[model samples]
Target: MIEELQDVPAGVVGTRVSGRVTADDFRDFKPAMDRMLDAGEVRIIEVIGPDYEGFGPGGLLADVKQGFSTLTHMRAFKRTAVVTDKEWIGHTLHALAWMIPGEVALFGMDELDAAKQWAAG
Candidate 1:
Protein backbone atom coordinates (compact mmCIF):
# COMPACT_ATOMS: atom_id res chain seq x y z
CA MET A 1 0.00 0.00 0.00
CA ILE A 2 1.00 3.63 -0.43
CA GLU A 3 -0.03 6.69 1.51
CA GLU A 4 0.57 10.26 0.57
CA LEU A 5 3.12 12.15 2.63
CA GLN A 6 1.54 15.36 3.85
CA ASP A 7 2.96 18.81 4.64
CA VAL A 8 5.47 18.77 1.81
CA PRO A 9 6.05 21.88 -0.32
CA ALA A 10 3.96 22.65 -3.39
CA GLY A 11 6.26 21.32 -6.08
CA VAL A 12 7.38 18.26 -4.16
CA VAL A 13 5.40 15.03 -4.40
CA GLY A 14 6.03 12.37 -1.77
CA THR A 15 4.66 8.96 -0.86
CA ARG A 16 5.46 5.99 1.36
CA VAL A 17 5.06 2.47 0.11
CA SER A 18 4.89 -0.67 2.21
CA GLY A 19 3.98 -4.38 2.24
CA ARG A 20 3.62 -6.54 -0.86
CA VAL A 21 3.03 -4.04 -3.65
CA THR A 22 0.32 -5.06 -6.04
CA ALA A 23 -1.17 -3.80 -9.29
CA ASP A 24 -3.75 -1.99 -7.19
CA ASP A 25 -1.00 0.09 -5.61
CA PHE A 26 0.11 1.23 -9.05
CA ARG A 27 -3.47 2.12 -9.88
CA ASP A 28 -3.70 4.14 -6.70
CA PHE A 29 -0.32 5.73 -7.32
CA LYS A 30 -1.20 7.09 -10.74
CA PRO A 31 -3.90 9.46 -9.54
CA ALA A 32 -1.50 11.24 -7.23
CA MET A 33 1.04 11.39 -10.06
CA ASP A 34 -1.60 12.66 -12.44
CA ARG A 35 -2.55 15.35 -9.95
CA MET A 36 1.05 16.47 -9.82
CA LEU A 37 1.26 16.49 -13.57
CA ASP A 38 -1.93 18.50 -13.83
CA ALA A 39 -0.57 20.98 -11.33
CA GLY A 40 2.74 21.10 -13.18
CA GLU A 41 4.62 19.88 -10.13
CA VAL A 42 7.64 18.39 -11.77
CA ARG A 43 9.83 17.45 -8.82
CA ILE A 44 9.22 14.19 -6.96
CA ILE A 45 10.37 12.34 -3.88
CA GLU A 46 9.37 8.72 -3.17
CA VAL A 47 9.91 7.09 0.21
CA ILE A 48 9.50 3.36 0.42
CA GLY A 49 9.54 1.98 3.93
CA PRO A 50 11.31 -1.15 5.18
CA ASP A 51 8.22 -3.30 4.77
CA TYR A 52 8.28 -2.88 1.00
CA GLU A 53 8.69 -6.15 -0.82
CA GLY A 54 9.02 -5.89 -4.59
CA PHE A 55 6.79 -4.73 -7.36
CA GLY A 56 4.55 -7.19 -9.17
CA PRO A 57 5.39 -7.74 -12.86
CA GLY A 58 2.30 -5.89 -13.98
CA GLY A 59 3.11 -3.17 -11.49
CA LEU A 60 6.58 -2.93 -12.98
CA LEU A 61 5.16 -2.58 -16.47
CA ALA A 62 2.81 0.16 -15.26
CA ASP A 63 5.75 1.97 -13.70
CA VAL A 64 7.67 1.81 -16.99
CA LYS A 65 4.70 3.33 -18.76
CA GLN A 66 4.41 6.05 -16.15
CA GLY A 67 8.11 6.81 -16.50
CA PHE A 68 7.85 7.25 -20.22
CA SER A 69 4.65 9.25 -20.06
CA THR A 70 6.18 11.56 -17.47
CA LEU A 71 9.60 11.82 -19.01
CA THR A 72 9.32 15.57 -19.36
CA HIS A 73 8.24 15.96 -15.75
CA MET A 74 11.07 13.70 -14.63
CA ARG A 75 13.56 15.71 -16.62
CA ALA A 76 12.40 18.93 -14.95
CA PHE A 77 13.24 17.67 -11.51
CA LYS A 78 16.63 18.51 -10.08
CA ARG A 79 16.75 15.50 -7.82
CA THR A 80 15.01 12.25 -6.91
CA ALA A 81 15.22 10.99 -3.36
CA VAL A 82 14.52 7.36 -2.59
CA VAL A 83 14.33 6.76 1.13
CA THR A 84 14.64 3.22 2.37
CA ASP A 85 16.04 1.21 5.24
CA LYS A 86 16.99 -1.54 2.81
CA GLU A 87 20.67 -1.80 1.92
CA TRP A 88 20.01 -3.41 -1.45
CA ILE A 89 17.70 -0.56 -2.41
CA GLY A 90 20.46 1.91 -1.72
CA HIS A 91 22.95 -0.09 -3.77
CA THR A 92 20.45 -0.51 -6.55
CA LEU A 93 19.67 3.22 -6.65
CA HIS A 94 23.36 3.99 -6.76
CA ALA A 95 23.85 1.61 -9.64
CA LEU A 96 20.89 3.01 -11.57
CA ALA A 97 21.60 6.67 -10.81
CA TRP A 98 23.16 7.18 -14.19
CA MET A 99 20.04 5.93 -15.92
CA ILE A 100 17.85 8.56 -14.30
CA PRO A 101 17.57 11.93 -15.97
CA GLY A 102 18.18 13.98 -12.87
CA GLU A 103 20.35 13.24 -9.85
CA VAL A 104 19.10 10.14 -8.07
CA ALA A 105 19.94 9.72 -4.41
CA LEU A 106 19.41 7.05 -1.80
CA PHE A 107 19.06 7.53 1.93
CA GLY A 108 18.70 5.24 4.90
CA MET A 109 15.80 5.59 7.34
CA ASP A 110 17.99 7.65 9.63
CA GLU A 111 18.70 10.12 6.86
CA LEU A 112 15.15 10.64 5.70
CA ASP A 113 14.95 14.21 6.95
CA ALA A 114 18.11 15.03 5.06
CA ALA A 115 16.78 13.33 2.00
CA LYS A 116 13.67 15.50 2.12
CA GLN A 117 15.75 18.60 2.54
CA TRP A 118 17.92 17.73 -0.43
CA ALA A 119 14.97 16.77 -2.57
CA ALA A 120 12.99 19.85 -1.69
CA GLY A 121 15.93 22.09 -2.44
Candidate 2:
Protein backbone atom coordinates (compact mmCIF):
# COMPACT_ATOMS: atom_id res chain seq x y z
CA MET A 1 0.00 0.00 0.00
CA ILE A 2 1.02 3.62 -0.49
CA GLU A 3 0.04 6.56 1.67
CA GLU A 4 0.93 10.20 1.19
CA LEU A 5 3.02 11.80 3.89
CA GLN A 6 0.90 14.66 5.19
CA ASP A 7 3.30 16.72 7.25
CA VAL A 8 5.79 17.82 4.64
CA PRO A 9 6.34 21.45 3.77
CA ALA A 10 5.14 23.10 0.59
CA GLY A 11 6.91 22.12 -2.66
CA VAL A 12 7.74 18.71 -1.27
CA VAL A 13 5.73 15.57 -1.94
CA GLY A 14 6.11 12.60 0.34
CA THR A 15 4.81 9.01 0.33
CA ARG A 16 5.09 6.03 2.59
CA VAL A 17 5.00 2.55 1.08
CA SER A 18 4.41 -0.70 2.88
CA GLY A 19 3.04 -4.17 2.22
CA ARG A 20 2.90 -5.17 -1.46
CA VAL A 21 2.87 -2.33 -3.94
CA THR A 22 0.42 -2.62 -6.79
CA ALA A 23 -0.66 -0.76 -9.89
CA ASP A 24 -3.71 0.36 -7.93
CA ASP A 25 -1.44 2.08 -5.46
CA PHE A 26 0.14 4.04 -8.27
CA ARG A 27 -3.30 5.04 -9.41
CA ASP A 28 -3.53 6.96 -6.17
CA PHE A 29 0.10 7.98 -6.16
CA LYS A 30 0.26 9.33 -9.70
CA PRO A 31 -2.43 11.92 -9.27
CA ALA A 32 -0.79 13.39 -6.20
CA MET A 33 2.48 13.71 -8.09
CA ASP A 34 0.77 15.14 -11.15
CA ARG A 35 -0.91 17.78 -9.04
CA MET A 36 2.38 18.72 -7.46
CA LEU A 37 4.20 18.71 -10.77
CA ASP A 38 1.54 20.86 -12.37
CA ALA A 39 2.16 23.57 -9.84
CA GLY A 40 5.96 23.70 -10.40
CA GLU A 41 9.14 21.84 -9.55
CA VAL A 42 8.91 19.69 -6.40
CA ARG A 43 11.08 17.54 -4.21
CA ILE A 44 10.10 13.97 -3.20
CA ILE A 45 10.51 11.92 -0.07
CA GLU A 46 9.69 8.21 -0.11
CA VAL A 47 9.64 6.20 3.07
CA ILE A 48 9.61 2.49 2.36
CA GLY A 49 8.87 0.44 5.41
CA PRO A 50 10.14 -3.00 6.31
CA ASP A 51 6.80 -4.55 5.45
CA TYR A 52 7.19 -3.59 1.81
CA GLU A 53 7.13 -6.78 -0.20
CA GLY A 54 8.28 -5.40 -3.53
CA PHE A 55 6.05 -4.73 -6.49
CA GLY A 56 3.63 -6.98 -8.32
CA PRO A 57 3.96 -7.50 -12.07
CA GLY A 58 1.22 -5.02 -12.75
CA GLY A 59 2.92 -2.60 -10.42
CA LEU A 60 6.13 -2.99 -12.36
CA LEU A 61 4.34 -2.17 -15.58
CA ALA A 62 2.63 0.76 -13.94
CA ASP A 63 6.00 1.90 -12.67
CA VAL A 64 7.42 1.81 -16.18
CA LYS A 65 4.56 3.90 -17.48
CA GLN A 66 4.75 6.34 -14.60
CA GLY A 67 8.53 6.47 -14.89
CA PHE A 68 8.32 7.42 -18.53
CA SER A 69 5.73 10.02 -17.72
CA THR A 70 7.92 11.46 -15.00
CA LEU A 71 11.01 11.41 -17.18
CA THR A 72 9.17 13.26 -19.87
CA HIS A 73 8.81 16.04 -17.32
CA MET A 74 11.96 15.26 -15.42
CA ARG A 75 12.71 18.86 -14.66
CA ALA A 76 9.66 18.95 -12.44
CA PHE A 77 11.54 17.09 -9.75
CA LYS A 78 14.32 18.94 -7.99
CA ARG A 79 15.42 16.17 -5.65
CA THR A 80 14.39 12.72 -4.39
CA ALA A 81 15.01 11.42 -0.88
CA VAL A 82 14.47 7.73 -0.18
CA VAL A 83 14.37 6.35 3.34
CA THR A 84 14.73 2.63 3.67
CA ASP A 85 16.56 0.09 5.77
CA LYS A 86 17.10 -2.29 2.91
CA GLU A 87 20.61 -2.37 1.57
CA TRP A 88 19.64 -3.43 -1.91
CA ILE A 89 17.19 -0.59 -2.34
CA GLY A 90 19.79 1.92 -1.24
CA HIS A 91 22.36 0.42 -3.60
CA THR A 92 19.91 0.49 -6.47
CA LEU A 93 19.11 4.13 -5.86
CA HIS A 94 22.77 4.96 -5.63
CA ALA A 95 23.45 3.31 -8.96
CA LEU A 96 20.51 4.96 -10.63
CA ALA A 97 21.31 8.36 -9.15
CA TRP A 98 24.12 8.94 -11.60
CA MET A 99 21.70 8.60 -14.52
CA ILE A 100 18.95 10.81 -13.12
CA PRO A 101 18.75 14.54 -13.85
CA GLY A 102 18.25 15.55 -10.23
CA GLU A 103 19.88 14.52 -7.02
CA VAL A 104 18.91 11.28 -5.25
CA ALA A 105 19.82 10.50 -1.68
CA LEU A 106 19.29 7.38 0.42
CA PHE A 107 18.93 7.26 4.17
CA GLY A 108 18.48 4.49 6.66
CA MET A 109 15.14 4.21 8.45
CA ASP A 110 16.64 5.91 11.46
CA GLU A 111 17.43 8.97 9.42
CA LEU A 112 13.93 9.72 8.21
CA ASP A 113 13.93 13.16 9.81
CA ALA A 114 17.19 14.06 8.16
CA ALA A 115 15.87 12.75 4.86
CA LYS A 116 12.80 14.93 5.19
CA GLN A 117 14.93 17.95 5.99
CA TRP A 118 17.10 17.34 2.94
CA ALA A 119 14.15 16.84 0.66
CA ALA A 120 12.39 19.87 2.09
CA GLY A 121 15.35 22.01 1.19
Candidate 3:
Protein backbone atom coordinates (compact mmCIF):
# COMPACT_ATOMS: atom_id res chain seq x y z
CA MET A 1 0.00 0.00 0.00
CA ILE A 2 1.09 3.57 -0.67
CA GLU A 3 -0.08 6.53 1.32
CA GLU A 4 0.62 10.18 0.68
CA LEU A 5 2.58 11.94 3.41
CA GLN A 6 0.95 15.21 4.36
CA ASP A 7 3.39 16.40 6.98
CA VAL A 8 6.19 17.18 4.54
CA PRO A 9 7.55 20.63 3.91
CA ALA A 10 5.89 22.97 1.47
CA GLY A 11 6.56 22.09 -2.18
CA VAL A 12 8.19 18.82 -1.17
CA VAL A 13 6.17 15.78 -2.13
CA GLY A 14 6.25 12.66 0.00
CA THR A 15 4.91 9.12 -0.16
CA ARG A 16 5.20 6.12 2.10
CA VAL A 17 5.13 2.59 0.73
CA SER A 18 4.39 -0.51 2.79
CA GLY A 19 3.14 -4.10 2.51
CA ARG A 20 3.64 -6.07 -0.72
CA VAL A 21 4.07 -3.51 -3.45
CA THR A 22 2.38 -4.20 -6.77
CA ALA A 23 2.09 -2.41 -10.09
CA ASP A 24 -1.34 -1.36 -8.88
CA ASP A 25 0.25 0.37 -5.98
CA PHE A 26 1.83 2.72 -8.48
CA ARG A 27 -1.61 3.52 -9.82
CA ASP A 28 -2.67 4.97 -6.51
CA PHE A 29 0.45 7.12 -6.24
CA LYS A 30 0.78 8.20 -9.86
CA PRO A 31 -1.45 11.25 -9.57
CA ALA A 32 0.78 12.89 -7.01
CA MET A 33 3.78 12.40 -9.27
CA ASP A 34 1.92 13.74 -12.26
CA ARG A 35 1.01 16.87 -10.37
CA MET A 36 4.57 17.30 -9.27
CA LEU A 37 5.79 16.87 -12.81
CA ASP A 38 3.34 19.48 -14.01
CA ALA A 39 4.74 21.91 -11.48
CA GLY A 40 8.16 21.76 -13.14
CA GLU A 41 11.24 21.14 -10.96
CA VAL A 42 10.55 19.07 -7.85
CA ARG A 43 11.82 18.09 -4.45
CA ILE A 44 10.61 14.62 -3.53
CA ILE A 45 10.86 12.12 -0.68
CA GLU A 46 9.88 8.48 -0.71
CA VAL A 47 9.73 6.36 2.41
CA ILE A 48 9.84 2.61 2.25
CA GLY A 49 8.52 1.81 5.67
CA PRO A 50 9.23 -1.17 7.91
CA ASP A 51 6.04 -2.91 6.86
CA TYR A 52 7.22 -3.06 3.25
CA GLU A 53 7.44 -6.65 2.01
CA GLY A 54 9.10 -5.83 -1.31
CA PHE A 55 7.67 -5.73 -4.80
CA GLY A 56 5.25 -8.32 -6.10
CA PRO A 57 3.99 -9.34 -9.56
CA GLY A 58 4.78 -6.63 -12.13
CA GLY A 59 5.92 -4.17 -9.51
CA LEU A 60 9.57 -4.21 -10.46
CA LEU A 61 8.83 -3.82 -14.14
CA ALA A 62 6.42 -0.97 -13.47
CA ASP A 63 9.02 0.73 -11.32
CA VAL A 64 11.66 0.47 -14.02
CA LYS A 65 9.38 2.00 -16.59
CA GLN A 66 8.45 4.87 -14.34
CA GLY A 67 12.05 5.36 -13.27
CA PHE A 68 13.15 5.50 -16.90
CA SER A 69 10.50 8.06 -17.64
CA THR A 70 11.65 10.14 -14.72
CA LEU A 71 15.28 9.89 -15.75
CA THR A 72 14.48 11.11 -19.21
CA HIS A 73 13.30 14.37 -17.67
CA MET A 74 15.61 14.35 -14.71
CA ARG A 75 16.13 18.09 -14.76
CA ALA A 76 12.64 18.47 -13.38
CA PHE A 77 13.76 16.85 -10.17
CA LYS A 78 15.93 19.17 -8.10
CA ARG A 79 16.46 16.60 -5.38
CA THR A 80 15.19 13.15 -4.52
CA ALA A 81 15.36 11.75 -1.01
CA VAL A 82 14.80 8.01 -0.72
CA VAL A 83 14.12 7.00 2.86
CA THR A 84 14.54 3.34 3.49
CA ASP A 85 16.54 1.14 5.82
CA LYS A 86 17.14 -1.45 3.09
CA GLU A 87 20.86 -1.65 2.41
CA TRP A 88 20.44 -2.85 -1.16
CA ILE A 89 18.24 0.09 -2.09
CA GLY A 90 20.72 2.54 -0.64
CA HIS A 91 23.56 0.83 -2.49
CA THR A 92 21.68 0.82 -5.78
CA LEU A 93 20.89 4.53 -5.51
CA HIS A 94 24.47 5.26 -4.54
CA ALA A 95 25.82 3.39 -7.55
CA LEU A 96 23.38 5.10 -9.91
CA ALA A 97 23.73 8.60 -8.49
CA TRP A 98 26.31 9.57 -11.07
CA MET A 99 23.94 8.82 -13.90
CA ILE A 100 21.05 10.67 -12.29
CA PRO A 101 20.64 14.37 -13.02
CA GLY A 102 20.47 16.68 -9.99
CA GLU A 103 20.98 15.22 -6.53
CA VAL A 104 19.81 11.78 -5.52
CA ALA A 105 20.18 10.97 -1.83
CA LEU A 106 19.42 7.98 0.34
CA PHE A 107 18.35 8.20 3.96
CA GLY A 108 17.49 5.62 6.59
CA MET A 109 13.84 5.29 7.60
CA ASP A 110 14.66 6.83 10.93
CA GLU A 111 15.80 9.96 9.12
CA LEU A 112 12.57 10.80 7.34
CA ASP A 113 12.46 14.23 8.98
CA ALA A 114 15.94 14.91 7.73
CA ALA A 115 15.02 13.66 4.29
CA LYS A 116 12.09 16.05 4.11
CA GLN A 117 14.27 18.92 5.23
CA TRP A 118 16.88 18.17 2.60
CA ALA A 119 14.44 17.56 -0.19
CA ALA A 120 12.54 20.74 0.59
CA GLY A 121 15.71 22.72 0.35
Instruction: Go through the candidates in order and give each one's C-alpha lDDT.
Output: 0.77, 0.85, 0.85
Worst 10 residues of 1 by lDDT: 36-45
**Candidate that would win on TM-score:** 2
- Location of the lowest summed lDDT over 10 successive residues in candidate 3: 65-74
TM-score of each: 0.86, 0.93, 0.88
Clash statistics: count for each candidate:
0, 0, 0
1 against 3, candidate with superior lDDT? 3
Write the residue-wise lDDT of candidate 2 on 1-121 in tens digits: 8899998877788899988889999887888978877877879899999989999658889887888887767777788999999888988887888876577888899998898889888
Give the distance in Å from residue 22's predicted Cα in candidate 1 to where it truly belongs: 1.9
Q: Mind giving the per-residue lDDT tens digits that candidate 3 earns over 1-121?
A: 7888999998989988899888998877788888888888888898987788889888898888778777656778899899999887788888888876778889997898899999998
Q: Give the TM-score of candidate 2.
A: 0.93
Q: Candidate 2 clashing pairs?
A: none
lDDT of 1: 0.77
lDDT of 3: 0.85
Output the better candidate (1/2) by lDDT.
2
Please report how far candidate 1 places residue 32 from its true position, in Å: 1.3
